[model samples]
Target chain A: MRASLKSFTPLILFLGLVVLLAFGLKTDPRKVPSPLVGKPAPRFSLPALQDPNRTVSNADLAGKLSLVNVWASWCVSCRAEHAELMRLSREEEDLQILGLNWKDDVVAATRMLRVYGDPYRVSAFDPDNQVGIHWGVYGAPETFVVDFEGTIRYKHIGPIDRTVWEQDLLPLIQAIRKTTNGHE
Target chain B: MNTNPAAPLVSVICEIFNRILIPIAPLRAILLTALLAVSTASAYTLEAFAFEDPAQAAAFRELIEELRCLVCQNESLAGSQAELAQDLREEVYRRFRAGEGRDEIVDFLVARYGDFVLYDPPLKPSTYLLWFGPFLLITVSTFFLIRTLLHKRQSPDSALSPREHEQLRELLDPHGSDRDGRNGPDQDKSDRER
Candidate 1:
């Protein structure tokens, strides 16, 4: 037993180190798990990006499955994710894409929307990022999947491509829908 | 003096110094002063947040210094120039001004950003590996180390027997066994003569 244990020690340590290093290499350091998941979405009322007279708030996200996409005109990833957002908006009629125009110039945000078809149901203008602070928004191109009851179910950091929408977001949305339907 | 190898080199170096270095000394000083001024101008300036007391200001500084900036992973909330870091600083300042203590402020940040915001992570089930993994590694390695050392100490191959010692001595000094055992003092004199 002692001889066997001695022989296995180097092999065990080598395998363990390989596993640890591979895991580290595969994982993205920037993708931090948000504590906001499973909690109610933070409340905020801000002026609409396009029409300053109109307002969008947490109340707007109520009684519907909403994808609160935190984006900005200055963010490159936001532009990258625009087509996906537009496609999602088109496909999922029930899914409301509530935009949080985080820390961006209003004119530029409006121009961006006009140029690349507006995917948002109603975009909230947050110039000073007061609402963003409450939402724990560190970077742009973050999307929060809020359930019908306004509880945040999932948060996707970085640009959302077609694969991400199908693989991660769709399954979660379907699961939430099934549960909600069963309860009702 | 002419025979000295470095004489020509030294005179040439002196000539170059007189022709170049002395003329550029004032210019180098001016250039150095400009560089110093640029560095001083670009030094970090803390955002002016009004505080009721000096104690509150110190606490606020300490709080931000501990909080990690999410945008720039390595920078603290106090040091990062990222807009998100600025927003976070403002949030901390707001909470501080409202008379909330350090724990409460940290808790609030953790609630939103998760434990990643804090420089010092709390002792929890999730963080057990992060906190104690190094010590556990040291302990395991030390156990193996001590075992190897003890094993080495007990190994018979390392210790020489009487016969092996004699053989080694003969091999090292070929004439020692043939020479007089009492005449060992004269061995060195014989060696010198040879």
Candidate 2:
């Protein structure tokens, strides 16, 4: 009886490991929580994608709720999320949506914008990805929600969909706006 | 052939040649092809970083390998061909060239990307399970194994009572031919005679 129980110990341990791994599998590895959440967003200045002579900086995003989306013309997910972003721009008139065009040819980025319809108030061209590095961007199709004080409140790491917009992002934006309006 | 003076030496040499070199020839060919395949596969263009100091360049290489690529979780920053990995490598090289210490550079990445960027996470409250979990399992298993062995050692001598021993003797000597009832000196002779 004792021998049988002793042999069963290994099976128990194996089952425990299986359960832990099963739980781990449910989590998306791509959605690792960013360290920049709740911290002030990084500052940067870059030439506008449409006009190289004109530039935009972090200062323009102050005193408003903003969405800073990191995207590239080559990123397929960016195209997938572009329509949602355009709809969001139309829906949220007060929300300032900015774009950081990461590591793409200027001509290609401009062409993509022309075809897809620009949703950003100002899309900053980041050919060298210097500003992207400062923003701690790992890849394209990442979005950050910055509060009125320019603090990054939330970060979405993949293509945004309607469900994500309604469930996670829109509620948070509304809450922040309510608090900011109360203070005013 | 047996009478030949050099027959034994020739046979020994043939045996050694057959045992060793015959098998190794094909294995060597396979290894050569594998090496060629690997070299050609990894010949894709990569961004290069120049450093004024060779030591700094070596440090940069080490640091990049130690950092994990967030986009490609399984690959190191140095090994990944992802664009983000390239940009990170560039960032590390830039920082190393700017006179940042290895710890400083790693800390900067950790601050921005969090501990996930590190292949080897630092020991802390949050990472205690990751760092010490294997050792904990080993220690627990060792404890149980030692306890089981100790219990087994004690059971044979102390756990068996006199009545149980008598029953065990009866079970072993089922024939019960001897009047002494125990397996004595006569029992061996009886078995040998049979």
Tens-place lDDT digits, model 2, residues B1-194: 37899999998999999999999999999999999999877553433688777877787888888999998899999888777787788788778878889999898888788899998889999889998999998999899889989988887655688999877887787575464556667778888999
lDDT of 2 by residue, A1-184 (tens): 9989978988999999999999999989888788899999988999999989988887878898999999899999999999999999999999989999988999899999898899999999998988887788888899999999999999999999899899989999999999999998
lDDT of 2: 0.88
- Please give each candidate's TM-score: 0.78, 0.72
Task: Kindly report the root-mean-square deviation of model 2 from the true structure over all alpha carbons.
Answer: 12.6
lDDT of 1 by residue, B1-194 (tens): 49999999999999999999999999999999999999877554674777868888888998899999998999999998777888888888888888899999999899999999999999999999999999999999999899989988888466788999987887798676565464565766897899
Docking category of candidate 2: acceptable
Q: For each model, chain A TM-score?
A: 0.96, 0.89
**Residue A90 CA displacement from its true place in model 1, Å:** 0.6
